[model samples]
Target: MSQETLFTKIINREIPADIVYEDELSLAFKDINPQAPFHVLIIPKKPIATINDIALDDRELVGHLYYVAKQLATEHGFSDEGYRVVMNCNENAGQTVFHIHLHMLAGKMLGWPPYTDNAKT
Candidate 1:
């Protein structure tokens, strides 16, 4: 079991979301704060809090998340061009919502290094 989160509420339909896709095992929705023109969040119905919380039994669920990402990318017409699928593990990695999810972003030429910084090199 996992703790309740904002996503859990979204999953349970207590909160409204810009939902795009949903199957028996997972759901895909738009990010409230989209980082790109095409930013979507793919999450599992089971509500595993973090990547570290995943167990061997979750292998298929995890893979299904990837599959959903690919499917969404293809459907949204960014598969050939390229896209990004990311999962933040903790605070340092920018995970605010505790529920594990895949951040799918595209619709432009995304750059590397992910983010800019003021840290001295």
Candidate 2:
């Protein structure tokens, strides 16, 4: 069996989180480290360790995560302003927690190339 990831801990309520939304298939919550004014982390309740681990049957669940992101943006009153959804794959991509999660970022205009590549100003 695989090890339980940090997200599984959150899903099981083993650790405390500023939960924002929850449903049968997924959960949404405020990120401990906010990247945007309106930042949220939406994750599947099922423990899928990484994006590469997602099975064929998980397509709907994955799509639901994005749907939840849309719902949250509208509920938080930022849908009209737009938002960004991101998923990191592995260490090189900055996937800190093993379990897959989608980041919902908004409340301010975001820049392209979200990260820097050591470019000069």
Instruction: Name the candidate that leads on lDDT.
Output: 1
How many angstroms is residue 112 displaced in model 2 relative to the true structure, after the best TM-score fit? 0.9
TM-scores for candidates 1 onward, in order: 0.94, 0.92
In order, candidate lDDTs are 0.90, 0.87
| Span of 10 residues, lowest total lDDT, candidate 1 | 112-121
User: In candidate 2, which residue ranges exceed 4 Å CA deviation?
Assistant: 117-121
- Given candidate 2, what's the lDDT at residue 114? 88
Best by TM-score: 1
* C-alpha lDDT (0 to 100) for residue 56 of candidate 1: 99
Kindly give the number of clashing pairs for every candidate.
0, 0
Candidate 2, residues 1-121, lDDT tens digits: the string is 2678777888889998899999999999999888799888999988888899999999999999999998998899988989999998877778888778998999888999987763211
